[model samples]
Target: MNNLLIGYARCSTDKQDLQIQRETLTSLGVAADRIYCDHGLTGTKRDRPGLTQALAAVRGGDTLVVAKLDRLARSVPDARWIAEQLTERGVRLQIGASVYDPTDPMGKMFFNILATFAEFEADLIRLRTREGMKRAKAQGKLRGKQPKLSSMQYKELRRMYDSGDYAISDLAEMFRVSRATIYRSLERTPVSR
Candidate 1:
């Protein structure tokens, strides 16, 4: 069987475009029909429909092409594991921008080094986020959204409740507040003019 060039493209959100990646793969000699695309999905997920289909279609000695290393996955461990899987199945993994190729010994070494760096960068980001959250909590800066209802609004809510024209849930929905907020407002003394 002739070696087939398969491409995979993914975008994290529906608003983002996958065309550039697709075009890059096509320019690199992958046929338009051979490119599989997944949109509005996260790379963190393992069960992507397009990715699964692309993997299933690939046979031994096939080349699986991606626009970039990150386009395949962000996690270094996951990336390494995926490379291993492809190699075990006799599939060659190629990154358009990276010198790392699973088919070559030097490329494999370079890929491992790059994966290690990616892992280190991810750890740093997680550590920085944790420290920032700790500082914010210490300063009492962590807070939820403020209540939307004003005292006058509370009065109106009570008046509407007294009318009994709407159910509790219905009143909550109409006011755009939660049922708990409505019940709490009902417990308060209605303000006089």
Candidate 2:
């Protein structure tokens, strides 16, 4: 069918619902049969089966539509690559009401700008998360995960390691942990008596 509209929707986790995206795409005139969805898959993952299928199904004049650009990809490289792929295939990509016309230089520029903003937003989120963690640590509220072993246990581990009588595997078996955990415990300072 010429001038077909195909839609894509994605949810990042199993707990998330794709209903909102589905509704939006349906309202935008994408037929149910024309809609593809990737469930419980991150935008960063390149192996999304639904996206692969959607891309494979598009024809020269067909439009691939999404509720939002982020639903397509959060990384600029991935977004730009996908846009280039569509351009090469003579397919149009649309996000909400905005369409990216690969034939138009201004449309390509706008799509690049959009992808840059998306990448920037992701970096800002990461920076904010790191800063928040640093502030929490400064306030003494950001202790990481509780230690798997107690101080006494760690001290005992170090003593056992230094004695050379027990193998790392033996210590791991004794402590009911992996050899890596035993090794990590051995690196701790000896506990005071």
Candidate 3:
């Protein structure tokens, strides 16, 4: 059998289309049968079902093609880890934007440098976000996320507790709140009622 040329494509959300990426890979001589795609899934996650299946299907001489590096993974660390895994298994990775072949020495060097930069960029973003949150907290402007249930919802919760038809767990699920919230709401009910 001919050495397989597998392609992987991913989009962050269901609203985004994978058509363009799929077309690009298909135009690059990758066959339709060998393409795996994950829709409505974040690239940061390592447990992508389509990606896992594609990786497993590849053999020693097979080539794994991605439209771009970022499409495969969100961070440099993840990219590097995936590259290492493919290399150890004698599989080749071909980034459509670059001519670097992961199996080649020059390609490996280039990929490592790129991965390092990616890691640095991710760390910088995280640091900036943390610093921003800290400043907000110091200014007493950070109230955190707003409460999910409104005043009306709280009233309904009280009524539901009074009716005594549903269990606390059921009320929690129906109202999309925690059991603790339900218990607290029930506690606040007037003794006469």
Candidate 4:
């Protein structure tokens, strides 16, 4: 049987478009139907349905095509593991227009270099995000999920609870809030307030 060119594409977030990668794969001669994709999945994540399907779809003599090494994997170990699997199965890896020959020392070196950079990029992104969040928190702008009840509403809820006439269920119904919310409010406020 003739070898096939199976393409794999991925986007880390749902907002990120996969059309460009798909077009690139098509331009590289991979059939549209043979292209697989994972949407809203980061390369750091191990469980990717598209990557699994692409790996399983490739047989001996078939080639797996990706737009870039980073698109295939963001970690060195994962990249190496995929390369090894392809090598053992007699499958070729095509990154962009170039076919990676795992047996070649230069190809192996290149793959490793590319994988390291991909991992580095991912690390840098994480660090930057953490720093941004930290700065926002310090500036008092990163207050996590806003309270469901307004401060005035909470005071009123507490007042109703302190009346001794309203049960927790009655207070929740009166406030149009959950019983758990009522319980939490009661826990936070001392009686007679």
By TM-score, how accurate is candidate 2? 0.88
lDDT of 1 by residue, 27-109 (tens): 88899999998898876677788988888878888888888766677677777877787777778877884434576788678
> Least accurate stretch of 10 residues (summed lDDT) in model 1?
97-106
lDDT per residue, candidate 3, 42-126, as tens digits?
8779989999988888888888888977778778778888888788878877778454567789878877876777667656877
Query: 33-108 in candidate 4: lDDT tens per residue?
Result: 9999999999988899999999999988898999988899999999898888887888888999999676577878
- Model 3 poorest 10 in a row by lDDT: 184-193
Better of 1 and 3 by lDDT: 3
Ranked by lDDT, top first: 4, 2, 3, 1
TM-score, prediction 1: 0.62
Off by over 4 Å in 3: 117-145, 148-193
The lDDT per prediction is 0.80, 0.88, 0.82, 0.89
lDDT of 2 by residue, 82-184 (tens): 8888898899888998877876799888888888887787778789999999999999999989988888888888888788799999988888999989867
For TM-score, candidate 2 versus 4, the one ahead is 2
Clashes of 3: 0
**Candidate 2 C-alpha error for residue 76, in Å:** 1.0
Best-fitting candidate, scored by lDDT? 4
RMSD of each: 6.7, 2.4, 6.6, 4.2
Check candidate 2 and list the clashing pairs: none
